[model samples]
Target chain A: MKNNYDILVIGGGPAGALAAKTAADAGNSVCLIEKRPAIGTPVRCAEGIGKELLKEFIKPDPRWIAADIERARIISPNGTAISLEQDKAGNEVGYVLDRKIFDRELVWQAAEAGADVIVKTRATAPIMENGAVRGAKVLSVGTPADIRAEVVIAADGTEAQFARRAGLDTVVPLREMMSCAQYLMTDIDIDAGSTDFYLGNEIAPEGYLWVFPKGDRTANVGIGISGRKSRDGSRAKDYLDRFVAKNFPNGKTIEAIAGGVPVCRPLACTVADGLMVAGDAARVVDPITGGGIGNAMLTGRLAAQVASECIAAGNCSKEALMPYDAGWRASKMGTILERNYKVKEYFVTLDDAKLNTLAESIAQSSLKEFSVLALIKELITRNPKMLLELKALRDTLS
Target chain B: MSTMLRINRDKCGYCGTCVAVCPEDALELIDAYLSLERECIACGICARACPLGALEVVHEE
Candidate 1:
């Protein structure tokens, strides 16, 4: 293994792998380090990604998809369910992936692009030189090693320590962070082509529970709640357990996982001298949906693109990496993410009654013309007092 | 002495998120269970990250 490289990427998820691949393909010596022995074990994501966003990078390979999602059903506390066809014009549509295979394939692509892939290599900390990140201190197979790099990309997922180590204000407040718990269950009846979302404080305080079909009779069922609201010590697993017992009483649990999801805006500063933060470490996840796989890949590519340019110019300073930051903010994702954060901040504050009202309104409205604006209009029309929140929602959606 | 981080194997789901969030690098999943190592500073991240509430910090008075 090389002790030095042009680009060193931490974490081996979608972002890190793509970053390594992009940089390496540009002829830079790149290395990707993953703490897990395997690329994707103990899967933490719900695995749903938008087709439009994903198509920009890699074509969807059938080997990675577990189910072709055709629609999404939103159920309110009052039991009113609103169904949205995934094929609706201008709507986002995609698949629920077999993340283990998908993640491994991504890293494999990175290796194919000439990036050295090292698994079971835990990045302990950012190696700082003159107050700037230059590489990482790693623990690979119980041996401490220092890998130096001209540029470092941190894609460390939800447990993001790398960016913080590099002086980025990456702290996600409890309210903005989503505590998630999920169960991979089988022998459960579900719409094999549709995803289901249950919304209610009783269901999941300040968040939603999702049932994403992996295939016939199997799904990844999970719940995410605002961490602050979970201060009562009621675990997300408890809510998930109750939801599962009620919805799929006889369902068998195949696997269970838990983690934090940063449902917030992107970091103000994701770049420092010779350092760039991508993926969950940079809080690129959609604030409203808690979906990030697509965004992570997008940011990874952009980060690497700018990093490669800087390396070529022989100036990997913070100012040189500003293009990555500017590039991300200029993209369509940048617009949506900036708006989604505000949407999430306000949406999570709505009480169960308000959510029930919103859901009921959407359910009663015409499905063909239904839109985010329509839902907000319906809510504001029903309750004039909801004008402020509705306006904020309108601002976000527009 | 600080509080000791305790892991209840029965409640643990073996997510390994606790190991990831432990700043002290004191946690690991071995044989489908979480094993606490000597480096534990009991910073409480693992306790918070444990989805099933399987970990606890018991301070000895």
Candidate 2:
């Protein structure tokens, strides 16, 4: 296999695959490296993606969709539930994806676009030359090898180790990280075409529990808790177990998973000379929802587009990649992500009483539909004092 | 040999994160409670992965 290429993308998830495919399709030699033996295994995500966000990039492939969501139900601590139809939620409708197939198909698309695919190849560190990232030291099938490149895209997930190795601050504070645990189980009763989110500090401190139905009698039951609230040996699994015991007493477990989600604003910087960070590495996830697959793919496409431009211009410096940062930040997703972070800051502090009250208010609201911001406005109208506490959020919404 | 990992069932949330992160795949959830199997190497990944601090690795020298 060739050791040198025009672009090298680390991690084979949606971001890496999209970046690699876009770059290669633009006629640059690209190589996508995945540490796992397969493109997608031991899946870590909750497997949900917003429908409208996804439609912007690729057509829905039936093979990867586990279930199509028609509506969502949010149950407050007091069991005050507010249900929202899909279209009413501002295109928040989504699908529970079969990430194994979806992730693999993305890498396959990359390969089909002329990028080389290497599995079981782990990037150990960035190769710095003249103070710029130029390649990586890797352990390929347990053998050390150096792969050189003009531009390196770090698509590594929440850990963001690659970006750090390249001298970028990608560290996620425990407070900003959400510890998640999920079980793919059978014999659980759920609406096959709807998703449920349960809120309450006891249910999931500083986070929420999700029941995403994959099919009849099967669902992905999980919970994500704020790491700050999860201190003192509190586990997300413990909360999930309690929820299941109470809700699905007869449910049987099929698979269990533990993962972390970065739930903060995007990093201040995600690009440097000869390097760019995409996806979770850049903290491109929605702070309020922890949804990232769509943003990751979008950022990947943008980064690659910028990389192609730089290659054509014969300038692979940080200045050349600056547009990638600007481009993403200017997009609709960038604005939404920024707003969501502010929303999370305010929402995470709401107690069960407040959450229940908020739910009740939503149920009584005359509006037929409401966006997240609209809901926030409705919430503020009920508790005017909240306007003072959420000044940043209030200003953003206004 | 007894496994070094001790799961506090009372505290375990049953998210199975420990089971998922266990490099050896030595952990499983039976009836929504944690069960340690023979393959466990006591790697402490599950201990770290446990958000509730429910899984503890007891070191006996």
Candidate 3:
């Protein structure tokens, strides 16, 4: 079967649609495909997106907002606490989003930009031709038909079949990935503008649990743990359920969803011949927070801009697409994401005693500089061994 | 009425796990992304595997 397009973008998610919109806006004919018939369904996200980050890509629209949050509180294993004080001005953690509405808006933007979108259609594989990605072969009726594109953007998320088919080997170690499960619950009498985080091995081993309020007495409550730690030990939902049952037993769960997150650095290579990957497939989620919506959208825009460039120049090789790679790392989002991964790795390894000591110190410290990084440095002062291990990671700081 | 699931492109991760675990092969990885072919019975297994929390299943309303 002959397949062809100026640009054939697979996966209509944030990355793919953005790629399509951007390319279309740039005067490239584009096709945006989706396997689902509707735009946003299933509700896998916690819906907590930083307001500041979203403002960078597109205007913040109320249609996509579920709730606005202001403060963040962290709870230790024994419930010891440390928080960024809140006075109700919306300072710390920001919005709890309406993921469904937000996704539709993006796709609509793409369509408005002139990309053709087809729902309930899935691309089966990258149609490899002469070792250069030309397009994809989709299964329309148990029969494979190829759709050719000068360039293919695999906004396909973490399990990248396009790159894999193209023979690009980039795997996030299981230990570096976080398994996540979340519940949208209602009737919880908690602070509407505050988000809570619970850290420490006793509560989450290699990860943490979060309660992000979403107004109307509802909240997105979830937990994630390093894959290696939770793979055989506890299912993500089980961990979340145990915690919720223990803490928010009276809170009624309205919906449940489970998934995984990549907290590692970006893949060693984000582009291959005729293709570029973005979002989760590229492991762009924040290492410490396990958040990716902002990054996914940002990376999607970057990928689209790069794809358009690739089409105009008629070259889609690694050399031509180097700007996407360089620019992404240079972006603040990239810097913070990589830095947080290091912080997460370092923080997860700290024991309860170390945690308690660190929390106590943060609670009482007023001698000088008050950056979170500075406090971590203070904790390391009491434990030189930790300093040695963290020294290499200290370079991980941007 | 024939049914189709819609993926809000903004919310999709083209992970083919939908195709991988789809018994009907309704979901397939195309161009390193996902699309539904004629075989889609609307089983949502592929939506489950996305780590980015991007996949969704919608009915033709």
Best by DockQ: 1
Give Cα-based local distance difference scores for all models. Answer: 0.82, 0.82, 0.71
Q: What lDDT score goes with residue A297 in model 1?
A: 94
lDDT of 2 by residue, A1-398 (tens): 68999999998999999999999999999999987778877687889888877888788989999999887788899998777786655555788999999999999999999999998887878999988999898888878999999999999776576777677776566567788888998987789988888999999988899999888889899889876666444678778888889999998999887677888778898889999999988899988788899999999999999999998998999998999999999998888888888888878888888788778877656434435666677667766665676575577674
Tens digits of per-residue lDDT for model 3, A293-317: 8888888789879878877887888
Worst ten-residue run, lDDT, model 3 chain A? A363-372
Indicate the residue-level lDDT of A224 in model 2.
92
State TM-scores per candidate: 0.91, 0.87, 0.81
Off by over 4 Å in 2: A87-92, A366-370, A381-393, B1-61
Q: Which model, 1 or 3, shows the larger DockQ?
A: 1
| Candidate topping TM-score | 1
lDDT score of residue B29 within candidate 2: 48
| Candidate 2 vs 3: which has more TM-score | 2
Q: Rank the candidates by lDDT, best first.
A: 1, 2, 3
**Candidate 1 true-interface contact recovery:** 0.26
Provide the lDDT at A296 for model 3: 85
Question: Tens digit of lDDT per residue, candidate 1, span A312-355?
Answer: 99999999999999889889888878877877777877888888
